[model samples]
Every structure is written in structure tokens, then in C-alpha cells.
Target: ENKPITLLELPTSIASNTILTLLKLITYNVIFAK
Candidate 1:
């Protein structure tokens, strides 16, 4: 049967890359702002 959990499973790679990019951006912003 189709379920909501299936939706969460579909984007693992994309989510990780997006999260990593966001983290890097935040870190760089903090460093430059200092």
C-alpha cells in the first residue's frame, strides 16, 4: 500500500546535498561576519 513514509524516502540524496550546502553557507557567513 502507498504510504506517507514512501514520500520521505524518495529524496535522500537531494536532501543531504541541500542540507550540506545550507550548512556550508551558514558557516561561511558566520566566518565572514566575524
Candidate 2:
């Protein structure tokens, strides 16, 4: 799902990056939180 985002806006870019990070953390937790 790594589409090319037009991150010309700084806050938008930061928010998206933060969301991606959170998603990764959640996925990891789901797998390891057994």
C-alpha cells in the first residue's frame, strides 16, 4: 500500500507517517500480545 503520496504539505506528511507507525505497532502487538 505504499502509494506515492504528494506530501507537499508538511503536517499532512507528518500525520500520515505517524499513522503508519501506529499501524505497525498495532500489528506487532496483535501478533505478540498472545
Candidate 2: segments with Cα more than 4 A from true spot: 1-8
Q: Give one digit per residue, the lDDT tens place, for model 1 in 1-34.
A: 7566566676996798899999999999999998
Clashing pairs in 1: none
Q: What TM-score does candidate 1 get on C-alpha atoms?
A: 0.69
**What is the alpha-carbon RMSD of candidate 2 to the true structure?**
5.1
How many residue pairs in model 2 have overlapping backbones?
A: 0
In candidate 2, what are the lDDT values of residues 1-34, reduced to their tens digit?
Answer: 9767575776798988999999999999999999
Predicted model with the maximum lDDT: 2
How far residue 6's Cα lies from its native spot in candidate 2, in Å, is 10
